[model samples]
Target: MSGSFRGEVRKLLLHPYPKRARDQNPSREGFPIRPPLNNEPRTADEEFASDTLRRMNEVLARIQELEDALDDPSQIWPRLRGAWKRAEDEADPRMSEIVRQAREISPVLKDLEKRIRRVLRRTRELTPLDRVQEMDRASMLWLSRQPGRTIAERAGPAQRILSTVRYENFDTLENRVFHSYVRLAALVAREWQREHRQAHGSDRFRLVDTLRLRCRAIACDLEALGVGLAEPGTTPNYVLMQDRGYRTVRQNWVRLLRRERILDDLWAWQAQTWTDFAVLAIVLAIDELDEARPIAQSPIVWRQEAFKGRWFDQDRPLAVFWLEETGRIVEVQARPEQPGPLLTLARAHVSLRVTDPTRTELPRRIAVWTPHAMQRMDIQVGGEDAASRLSEIGQVASGEIMRDGLILTPAQGDPQHLVASRGKAHVDVIALDASGVSLALGMEALREFIRRDIWR
Candidate 1:
C-alpha cells in the first residue's frame, strides 16, 4: 500500500512517464541521432514495431513489479507472462521497429532478469510493506511541506486543451503525433522517475514541456494504482523508493544523461519537494462529484438517546454517512488522529442499509459512528438482528437519541447541516457522504436475512 512497484507496472500503457519529468524529452525531430524515417505508410512492420516497444516497456514494468514483489515466483511470473502475451498480441509492424531499438537498452529478458534480481535482493534485505508505509508518510510529508495552493494557481490553457482533447480523443495527425510523444515521454520520464523517488522534478529530462508530462505521469500512475487494486495480485508490497541502492542507480542514470541536457527540471523537483495537489485536488474533486450527492439542509441535533459511548469506526463510508444524516446531539467523541487535514461530521444513531457496488441492490448493513454526532446510528441493509450483528462486528454500542439540533459539517464547508433524515422508525437517519452511502435495511434484504436466519 505504501510503495509504488504496483503503480509502475500497471501504469505503462496509460502514463509511461514519471510524475515530474513528463514532457521532458527532447523533440524527436531534433534529436542528435536522426529520427527514423518510414517512407511507407504505417504498415504491419511499423505497427509491429510500436507493439514491440509497448510490449518491451510492459515487460520492463512487470520486471519492476516482480522485483518489488520479491519474485513471489508462484504469483508474479504468471503475471509477467500475461503482460508479455498481452503486449505481443497488441503488437503491429511499427511495434517491430520499436523492438529493434529496444535492444539498444538491453534484451528484454536480460534487462528484466537484472531488474528482477536486483529488486529481489533488495526486498530480501528490507521489509517492503513497512518501507511502503514510510514512503507514504514521506509523500505526505512532501505534500505538507508545500503550501497548499488553489486550483487557479495551476489551471490554465493547457488544462483546457487537455480537457477538450480528453473528451475528443485526439484523432488528428498533430494530436496523434502529440499523443505518441506523450507516450514516449512518459516511458522516458519513468526512467528518470525510477531514479529519483522523491516527488520533485529531475534534471536529466528537461524539456519546456516536462512538468506537464510529469503531471500526466503521476495522474496516470495514480489512476493505474487505483485500477490495479481492483484486481487481485496486481498490488505489490513495495513502494517506489524503497531501496537506497535503487535510488543510487537512478541518480547515476541521470548523471549519465545530464550531458544530453535532459532531466534538470525533473531532478530538481525530485531533490526539492513540491505539491501538485492543486491539480490532484481538482481531479479528486471531479471524481467525487460523480459519486456523491450534496446534502441540502442541516438536521436537528439530539442528545445520546440511542448509543452510550463514542468509539472509532474504520468503515470510512459508514462513518461519513452517519455524520451527514445526524447532527451533533450526543456527546460526539473524536477526530482522526493522523497529522494531515481533518474532516468533521455528525454521528450515526441508526443503521444504514444499502446494496453493494459489485452487485446492484444486493442488500447489506453497516454500523456507523463518528466524532461529532454520537447518538445517531446508520445502517446499510439488514434487520435488528443483522444490525446487532454488524454493530458487534464494528464494536460500537447502540445508542438512544436524546435531543436534536443542526450541528454537522458538510464535506465542502464548516456549516453544520443534516444532509438526510428519515422519519420512519425502522430507518433512523440516512446520509450519503463522499465516501459511502448510509441508509436503513431494505425490506428485501431484511426478509432474506429473517428467512435464512443469517445472524449468528
Candidate 2:
C-alpha cells in the first residue's frame, strides 16, 4: 500500500500538465508563442511607434504655442522665463533649441522696453505745457538731449508771453511788428547757437554769455536814456528764461522801466508802444551782432495821410530796413514825411543804411513831381536793365534825390501816374506822387491783392 501511494504522488508531479501536453509539445509548456526567429510580428513595434509619434506631436504643439507667444513684445520676457524653466527640467533636446532662440531675442526685447519707458517719462513731464501726443513725445525725447534747455523748456513761457501780448487781438501794424520781433529773436537765437557751437565745440558755456555783450550794449543805451541796472549780486527775478535772447531782452526792458519809475505804465501802455519798444530793443541787439550787414541804400518807407483838421493833414512815413547777411528786418522807423527824412534819420539815429543795392528791394518806378515844372517823372527801379534805366532817368532829371540813391525824371505825358514795382519780402507796393512816397501796401495788402486779382 505504501509503494502504490508513492507511485501515485510521483505520477501526479511528473504529469501535472498532461492535458496541455496532449494538445501541444511538452517543451512549449509555460512558454509564449512567437513568429519565426528571423521575421518577428509587426504589431508590437507598430504600436510603440504610433505612441512615440503621438507624444512627439504633443511636444511639437506645445513648442508652437510657445513660439507664437514669444513674437509679442509684452509676452517676450514671460515666455522666455517659462521656456528657460522648462528647458532646465526637461530631458527633451528640442527644449534646448527653444531656450537658445529665447536668449538670442532677449537683448532686443530689453532695448525696446527701455525706449518705451523713456518716452513715457518724457510724455509725462511735458504734459503740463500742451497735450503731448505720441509724435510730440518723440520730439521731446530727441530735443531733451540738445545743447541747452531752450527748446525743452521755452514753449510754455513763449505761449504765455503771446497771451500777455494779446496776439489774437492785434491790429495790422501791431501784428506786423510783433511777428517781426519774433522772427528777429528766432534768427538771433539760431545765430547765437551756431556761433557758440563753433567757438566752444561741445564745451559747456553759460546761456547768458550768448547775449551778454548785446545785453550790455542795450543796458548802456538804456542807461544813457536815464535807465539804471539792478544792483550787482541781486537775484534775477524774471520768470522767462527758456530763450536766452528773449530773457535778456525782457530783463533789460524791466530794468529800464524800473529805473524810469514807469514800471506800472507797462500794463497801461498802448499796443503800439509795446511793439515799438520791443522792436527797437531787438533791432539794436541784432545790429551789434557780427553777422549783420547793411541791406539797403535808403530805408523803404510807407507813407499815408493822417487828418488833423478840416483843411490840415499830415503825411506819415513808416520806414522798413533789413540786414543783408541774415535777410532779417532790423529797423522799422515811423516819422512825419519830409523830402528825404528817412535817409537822414537812418544815418543819424540808428546808424543803419542800405549800402547793398542788390540786397535792397527798391521801388520798381520812383516818381518825383515838382509843382513848378508841373511834371511827374517815373524812375524805373527793378528789372533786368535797372542800372541803365536809372542812369537814363538820372540824365533826364536835375540830380539824384534822397541820399543820391534814387533818380527822378519829368513825365512828359500824364501828371498822375502809377508806380509799379515788384514787391519785396515785407514791402509790397510803393506809390510816389508829388506829395510823398507810400509803402502802405504791406504784406497784408499784397495778400489781399493776390486774393482779389492773381488767385482769381
TM-score of 2: 0.15
Listed in order, each prediction's TM-score against the native is: 0.16, 0.15
- Model 1 worst lDDT run, 10 consecutive residues: 271-280
- What are the runs in model 1 whose C-alpha is more than 4 Å off? 1-209, 212-456
lDDT per residue, candidate 1, 1-456, as tens digits?
Answer: 011221232111111122232344431221111112222226655454333223223222322332323235334324433333332221111111122223232232233223322111111111222133222444444434544364232333332111101122213222222223334434544443332233234232233125335435533543442311111112222321344432332333333333123222222231111011111111122123223232221221221111111111222221121112222111111222321111111123222233333434323332233212111232332223233333333332222221111111112111111222222112222221111111011212222322222121
Give Cα distance to truth, residue 29, candidate 1, Å: 48
- Model 2 alpha-carbon miss at residue 39, Å: 99
What are the lDDT scores of the predictions, listed in order? 0.25, 0.28
Model 2 agreement with the true structure over 1-456: per-residue lDDT tens digits: 011121232111111111222334344343112121123236765444333222222223233333444366344324533443333222222222223323332343233223211111222233333443344544555555545556435454432111111112212222222223222333333333332333343222233233333333433433343323333224433322443433433343333224222212211121222222222222333333455443432322211211110111112222234544544443323222322322221121111122234554432222211111112223333321333333343433222222211112222222222233222211112122111011111212322422222111
